[model samples]
Target: MTDFRLVIVSAGVSDPSSTRLLADRATQRVSSLAEKRGHTVTTTVIDLRELLPELPAAMSSQLLGPRFTRAVDALVRADGLVVASPVYKAGLSGLFTSFFQVIDNDLLIGKPVILGATAGTARHALVVDEEMRALFAYLRTLPVPTSLFASTEDWTDKALGARIERAGRELVLLMESGFARAVRDESWDSYQHSYGSAGGTELDIDLSSDMMRLATGGSLRDSDDDPFDPRRA
Candidate 1:
């Protein structure tokens, strides 16, 4: 059996928020699905509300403290993620966005993510696809095909449960198939730009490329006299 690590991030503010409820349901469903597929799943839930005080420091310094660092580490190491947040004024919670903002841009590359959101009105359901998907796309995370959005009315709707299960199954399948790891191992470097790479150096560039030759005005050559040539440097 394969071992899978799943991290659930709940960005709910209130003590008994619907956002957290959705996250819990999603996590449980995903865990159950993974178990059924003969994979052992270990889940960690991070409540962003608990780290509110530290957020200011994290945002200002652009650094994660010990507690938040541990949370981020869990996220980075996880095989899959369930991220849920409450919608406020047609946008995601600032706390939710702030928590993610401090994370390294490359940390979530190719990780499988299941996006979810809770709002008081059904009109905000699109927040899951429009805002949350956009955010995860920026991080280069592979969000599952199904996304869950829970509105006040959706709690009593049986369809909500179906959607949750569908999303969970998709995430479990992605995990079991090892697609995330394959993408990360094979194509991650191709997706990443040389600047600010994880190793703190640019990828090897071909000076013979038309772009490089044009940028150097065709003056750069392979000889040692060409100071701009990386080989000479």
Candidate 2:
């Protein structure tokens, strides 16, 4: 029963937002599990709609600097994260997407994030899985195996409740693993930044020359290896 904090990123309107509902349910499941383990749990809920015109896509990085900074801070300080959003026109809400895009990717590296979403039908569930995973991938976050999706019908569905419980457990397990490994690996991650700046692979000089040689009928050679023979290693 260690102390753990969970952050919910919900992009939903103030009304009966299915996004926040699903997120709340998921958090409850995790909090219950935490209680059972005698662990204290704290939560910070950030509703993108609550963020207002400040969260507009184009200005998300600037106007919402404090909020955006808090979001990044939450990712760093929290043991795990649950991101829930309502689908919008076959895509994730712009607020959610922009919020993520503006952050420092290093904050999410190796963090366990649970992907969840709500929509009118079940058909869009897989979209969250694939597209959402891609986003986490870019952030270098380790996503849990169980992704939560709630269709309009799922709001009151019993099975959906069970699924939320399962996702919560899965997320907890991932975070626990991270906690254990992070202690040992934290040094490496922290010091890795002190090394050389982001390095792209060196230009393949050999390949470049080979291609040129082929393109010009062996005009380019391995000059480094054999200057006279016109062949460079």
Candidate 3:
């Protein structure tokens, strides 16, 4: 049986947060479904509240504390992800967005992810699909077709559970297909990646390139070449 790693990032701030509750439910379903498919699933939970102390440093100086470092490590190794956030002022929690904003741009590329969000009122239900999906899209993550959003009333509603089940199954199917891993293994170079990005595992560099030479204070043209010649320029 193939083994898969799943990471759950919960931006819940309360002890019994609905946000985390939603995320946990999704995680459980995904695990169960994957197990039924004869796959082993390992999970890592990253509670964003625990990383609050590191957020400022991460945002200000790009310094990752121990917990933040661990979070990034978990994300890098994750085969699939369940990300849940709380809504505030008609938008996603600042803590939720901030944490992702500080990570490498290519860290989540091609990774299968499920978007979930919790808000007090049903009015904010669209936040997950409208805002959170956009953020994951920018990271180039492959979010499942089903998105989960829960309001206070949705907690007891059967519809929320249905969505969670659908999302979980979708995630499991995507993971089983190994789409993300295949994309990374086969077409990784086709994607745009910044230097030292992807949690610093992307170390490939072409020393002979003009950009590299210029960055290292090396001249593109040799001393023997004519300085003003268009052919040598």
The best candidate by TM-score is 3
Please identify model 3 stretches exceeding 4 Å from their true place.
213-233
TM-score of each: 0.84, 0.75, 0.92
lDDT of each: 0.86, 0.72, 0.93
Q: What is the per-residue lDDT of model 3 for residues 18-112, given as tens digits with 9 covering 90 to 100?
A: 89999999999999999999999999999999999999999999999999999999999999999999999999999999999999999999999
lDDT of candidate 2 over 1-233, digit per residue (tens): 67788888898775888889888988998888877867777898877776565566436334445565566566567787889878877788877887777555455567777789888888888867878889988876777788888887887789888888888888777766765247426643442331221121112234454665667656554566556654443
Model 1 C-alpha lDDT per residue in residues 1-233, reported as the tens digit of each score: 88899999999999898999999999999988888878889989899988887898889985567778778778767899999999999999999998888777777878889999999999998998999999999988889999999999999999999999999999988888887788777887666555543323335666677668768755445557777766554
Least accurate stretch of 10 residues (summed lDDT) in model 2? 194-203
Clash count, candidate 3 = 0
In candidate 1, which residue pairs clash?
none
TM-score of 1: 0.84
Best by lDDT: 3
Task: Please list the Cα RMSD from the true structure of every candidate, rounded to 1 decimal place.
Answer: 4.7, 8.1, 2.8
TM-score of model number 3? 0.92
Off by over 4 Å in 2: 56-64, 179-184, 187-233
Pairs in clash, predicted candidate 3: none
Ranking by TM-score: 3, 1, 2
lDDT of 1 at 161: 98
Error of 2 at 113 (Å): 1.5
